[model samples]
Target: MGAMVYWVILSLSILALGVWVFWSVRGVRAYVRARGKRLVTCPETHCAAAVELDAKGASWKAFRGGNYFRLQDCSRWPERQDCAQDCLQEIETLGQGCLVRTIVAGWYSGKTCVYCRKPLDKVEEWTGHMPALLDPDQKTVMWGEVPPEKLPGVFENYKPVCWSCHIAETFRRVHPELVTDRPPRW
Candidate 1:
């Protein structure tokens, strides 16, 4: 009788261990499959930040906010009045995933214009690369076109500018002399 009792106890323990192992493997696989680039709002509506996360739970699509301003506060950028970039960081999501698919082009997926506070759909989105220097000399911006090798890597040192602003700025940088002296026809 004692021997039989010991065997039963051992079998129960082995079964429990097996169950735990299976669940662990399942969870790890889920994490790997779901791991990738993602975008999300802070949920509070207006604030700074672009949070990325690794999660283990049912996937979800982003909420359809009426406008980019609702998704993120653009007021962070006051000098240019253009919301060029949203502060970015990564976090491991717990039990749920917090993410929205980005258009993969601009800092914020070409959603808002980096110049005017306008909807991206109405204006053409331009991927503007930052020259090697933060404030490139007038000559570089106007006359010199830095080769691809010298340009910053994708998603680095870039902003989404509207067509009008892009054309205006491009000329300002590439041919500063052409437009500087001419006064705006107000």
Candidate 2:
């Protein structure tokens, strides 16, 4: 009877450990997925705004099977931040679709460089191999050069340029005397 009771206690302890592991992993996944700069239209002002989620709070809530979220930062702050965060509803519904990375990736898809005519591939956000945007005045600028708040406007007005062209154009623009414009050999 003593041996049987000991085995039962050990089994219950293992089961409790398993449950804790499951819940912790679930919470971590929720944190990673929610941590990012999200673009959402402010329901109050009906305009585009950059917002970040309170990922730490969301993760903690996830452990209890709840998915609560609130604003950690916003572009419309200091003036209208105290207003109700109706934008979170958009984020909850859109999920990854509202992420800035997703929006930029969609813009770059199927696009060719305005300068060299090279087809743009995936924008490597992590690999440091990103394309650039050509402004209306023929200025070349990388995505990082644009602020998060201005991304929506930049996407609407700027044209995509492959990395190679961006580098060449930037060099030429900076040092015109060093670069001789040559007609295409073809």
Runs off by more than 4 Å, candidate 1: 39-51, 54-186
lDDT of 2 by residue, 63-158 (tens): 778976899899998788697999988998999999988888888888888877877765554267688899989999988888777887888899
Q: Which regions of candidate 2 fall more than 4 Å away from where they truly are? A: 1-9, 121-126, 175-186
Candidate 1 lDDT tens digits, 8-82:
999999998898776666666555545543344323443323333323341222111111111222222244234
How many residue pairs clash in each candidate at the backbone level? 5, 0
lDDT leader: 2
TM-score of 1: 0.28
The C-alpha TM-scores of every prediction are 0.28, 0.83
Instruction: Count steric clashes of candidate 1.
Output: 5
lDDT of 1 at 80: 28
Number of the predicted model whose TM-score against the real structure is largest: 2
Instruction: Indicate the worst ten consecutive residues by lDDT in candidate 1.
Output: 62-71
